[model samples]
Target: MRKNSFAIGCACFLVFALLRYPQAMLEAGAKSVTLWFQQVLPSLFPFMVACGLLLRMGAAEIVGEWLKPLMRPIFGLPGIAAFPFFLGIFSGYPMGAKITASLYEERKITLSQAEHILSFCNNPGPLFLVGTVGAAFFHAPFWGYIFLFCCFLGAIATGMLFRLFYFSKSVNDFIPYQKTPSPSITECLPQTIADSIDTITQIGGYIILFGVAVEAMKQTGIFHFLGNILSFLPFSEEFLCAMSGGILEMTNGTFLLSTAPDNLSFRLTAACMLVAFGGLSILCQTLGVLRNVPIKKSRYIAAKICNSLCSGMIFFAMAPFVEKYAQKTVPTIAFLAETAFTIPIFYIKSSIFFFACAFLFALYQRR
Candidate 1:
């Protein structure tokens, strides 16, 4: 009770402070709003609607069965997890949580399966990583792709690790429930669009609030206090400030990181780690989607930490190669990079992983 009250008090104070600094608030708020309108909504809306259509048409179940061998063996999750699992990677952010929670709500997946999916599914989408972070921020599209790939690997590694430590279920343990095939696009399209808009609007609100709050904190020197508190970490104050911004909101963190006096390798690794973490704004959105579910937030946070660390490790390993090639700036590579990820390797790999996991899970169940 006291904690809740304290949180409310803090919120009130922040609101008051922001109101006192209107110019800072507007500048911070506007960029987040523009990013959402210019980038996030345009990219996410179609994906959300398409996913809505696909799952409704029973494509998920069909593909889940086909890929059971991989998913079960690798992730120890039911085949049905493949659809949203792939969406989480490709579509980005709370999609994994949204799709997984929707599945659980419909009784398509179990609580354990939903929570496990949640651990690694809530990651940055390719559009942001490649388009915004990679091209706009780094001036290299290939680097964005590299970060996306690292996060992909990190999510998979996290899934496998969770299979070992968290999920011990057999493939056959998943409750095989029938799905209602809604192939009526004529009837569904309008509703799907409406739902997409609503969801995207809510997500934009989170982005705006977090973005503005981070900028406010920076202007108010709240991060200075944070830097002092974290001074024991053996890193520079600038790095600490960047990380602090990241913990609050990813976009803010990304901007701050660009100003850090670190080498490309160090900054790239940090950026990759931050993207993998998905920041508090995204996590809040995920939890909001899963509000009615019985899963714990700590598990989700642990998953983010584990995946971010894994991404950091992978980035370090790939830095030598990435930096070498990144210097080449091959025009051919850009075209290929642009066209190749469009082919849905995320879906293909997920299917294969699903199939593997299913095969192993069935074997485990039989034993």
Candidate 2:
């Protein structure tokens, strides 16, 4: 009861402060809202919907069966682990945590397995990395792919570590395992789309809220103060600033890193490390999804650190090669002409075309 009261008191104080600075609050809130509607939502929504439909439609069993041979040997996990592993790589961020929780809640995975999965699965989505961060911010689409590749490598390294310690399962151990039956596409379409939208909206809310909080910190110069403290160490000012922002929120931190006055390798390394760490916001989302399941917080944090370190090392190793080629991959004018003029129309048309194709295929399959 005392703790609850103290928490409430703290919350009230924060609210009061924000109200007192209505201008700052409004500006911060607007920026957060714009990032959601304009950037995050468009990039992640399609993948979220696709992942939801895939998972519910029994794509897990299919994937699990196919990947079982390699997954068991390499990851020390049952083939069922493939679902969240792959989705986390592609769908990004909290999706891995969310899927892991679903697997646990439905008794598809054990507590230990779920814990190991969290160590590696929660990652930045490829679309955001490649499209938004790479193309829009860095002006190098290759950087996005580089980040994605390093993330996958880092995740695999983390998995190998876990396989040696926590997971003792071998290829022969899971032969008896079975998967859930998926519904026909027509049968699951409505729920798939609905659940995807709901999850995306919740994710959007968290992103926006965290964005505002980061903005508030910036407005108050807290990040600079934090950077000053870090300057005592060997880290650079740019990295310190990036870390200060990334520590709270993933997207905000990555965005900040892009603008940091550092070499491409330094900035890219920092961004990849932060993505692997996944910031506190990502962890909160992960734990919230896993609230019902038994999880060891200390172990989880340690795993994330290990994963981050692994990602950082891999990023540095290939970064020189990446930088050498990324800048010259395409001419500026041609790239601009395509991105500015040709892509939007093609993207919209392709999206519509695919949806129509899926609709027709579903109808035929249903009959």
Candidate 3:
């Protein structure tokens, strides 16, 4: 009852805010749409379609066969768990949750395995890290590489920590695994594209909604007030505001961080923290994907929080080596232009090629 009332009240407030500040809302929505088109769509769509196709084609299960030995020792999970983990690494957020949920629904992975994978599998993909953060925001792909490295280590650490303390000792208890239904490629391709479209559309909606909400807060000076409330912290008001934005929605937060004071370490650390945390928007997306599953929400949230902290610590530990080895200087405009132009093309072409190859492999195996 209380939750319902709070939700209703929040919705009312948002409606009022939208009416009160239509222009701000419009502008924010437009920016979010632009961001989605340029970055999110290009980076996520291909990979999502590919992932879906792979699952339907039974390719991931094939790969899982070989990974069982390694997966058991390190993560205390079945080899199939490797599919979501690596796919999440390559493809990015919510995909991990989606794949895990799909696995659970198919009764391929046990509930325990699903829950264990959920803790650390969902991650920011390399495209976003390298192209969006590295090339566009920081003008240096090097920072993106550093962030990815730290995030990967943090994910590993989180998984290991959970394996050590949280998961039960009896890891061998397995659900009788069922292989995914093998839909023909002709049938699978269209459905995979359709599902990917829906998923990307859902993501865009969240981005726009949160983008407008954040903008509304900023317009109303609520963001500034909130920042001031956190002035007691060691960081600056601008930094606090950026973090606040990030806490609600990661893309906007990182966008703000890019414009913050030119403190490399501070900016990188804050960006990494937000990326790892994945913001409230991402949480909603994750939940949306996993809603039907009986997974424990509290534990999932706790795992993400721990993962965020762990990533920050790992970044700090590796800061010295990264600083020494990686170049942080702003790149030339021509270079940025080159990177920006090529990345979307690369993502699209690569994903298509990857899926085509996988589809052929599956077809050949059937024959």
Candidate 4:
């Protein structure tokens, strides 16, 4: 009864705001639509379609078989987890959670593993991090590479940390994995495209609504109030405002940070945190996709918060190097690959070693 009343009240407030500030709402909606049509649709649609096709083609089982050894020991997850991990990394935002829910619904992964994977797999795609953020926002593709590496580093850390403390009774329960049918490409292409369209449309709706919500918050002074609350943090006014915006939505927050008259290091740190956290808008999108699956919202929220902090720390540590490398003018695929590999190798290997040691310790204790 209380929940229903709260939702009703919120809806009424939104309607009132829309009527009160029609211009702001309209502009916000237009910008969001443009962003979705130009950037989000092009980058995400093909990946979504590809992911749907891969799963439909039984790619999970195949990938799982190959990845089982690495996944089990390091992450304490099933081999099937690779499906979401790689796809989520490549596709970015909610895809990881989306795939996990699908796997759970299909009985490919148990509930606990689904929850565990949620901690780290979902992230912003390379295109966004490198092209949109690095080149477009910061005017330095090198920082984009730094952000990508740090963001992924944080994710990897979150996974290992979660595995260390995770306890579940069904961790050892073996369930027969569902084998997805490998239909002909021509046969499955239409359904896959249809499903991808539905998914992207839902994402588009959320983006536009959140865009309006941000404008509404601004018109009502709520956005300023939120920013004012964080003034004690030693950051500039612009930084505080950007952070507040980021708490509501990721892209908006990062754009604010990029435009703020602050040092590059501070902006980089804050952007990493916001991107990793993925904002309330992203949380809603994840919830929408997983609506049919029974997963704990609280746990997902906690994981995102942890991930943000982890990524922020990484960005801080690497800020010096980023500043040193900020002058790389000719940013290309080779440079990105080279930078990603060289910079994160030490951290990645250390994390893997630490997790492997912990896994062995767990085995010893069990014995």
Q: lDDT per model, in order?
A: 0.78, 0.73, 0.79, 0.79
RMSD of each: 4.7, 7.9, 6.3, 5.1
Cα error of candidate 4 at position 262, Å: 3.2
- Which residue pairs show backbone clashes in model 4? none
**Lowest summed lDDT over 10 consecutive residues: which window, candidate 4?**
334-343
Q: Which sections of candidate 3 miss by over 4 Å?
A: 176-181, 332-337, 340-367
Give the per-residue lDDT digits (tens) of candidate 3, residues 1-367.
8869988987887888899999888888998898788778987888888888888888877777656656666788877888999899888887898888877886778777888899999999887777677767877776777777788878988998888644574276655446656889998899889878987888888888888888877887887998899999887788889999899988778878888874778788889988998999999889888877888888988899889899988887777665755544555433123453222333356557855765565455446
Clashes of 4: 0
Q: Residue 124 of model 3: what lDDT? A: 91
Query: Where's the lowest-lDDT run of ten residues in candidate 2?
Result: 333-342
Query: Could you give candidate 4's per-residue lDDT for residues 1-367 as a string of tens digits?
Result: 7869977986787898899999988999999999889778987888888888887788888878666666766687877887898788878887898788878887888787888888888888777777667766666766766777788889988988888645452246445566555789998799889977888898999999999988888788876787688878777878888888889998778878988888868888999899889898999988888887887889888888999999999999978754765745534433122233233444456657966875566556446
Candidate 4 yields a Cα-based lDDT of 0.79
- Angstrom error at residue 55, model 1: 1.0
Candidate 2, 1-367: lDDT as tens digits: 8869976974675576477677887787787777778766786677776776777777777777656555666677777787898788888877888788777776767777888777888877777667666666667666777777788889889888866557554333444556556688888778767866776677677766676667667776788999998898666777788888898886677777877777767888988898888897777766765678788998888888898999999999987754665744433422112342122333346547854764565445446
lDDT string for model 1 (30-71, tens) is 988987897778778888888887776778788777666667
Report how far off residue 60 is in candidate 1 (Å).
Answer: 0.7
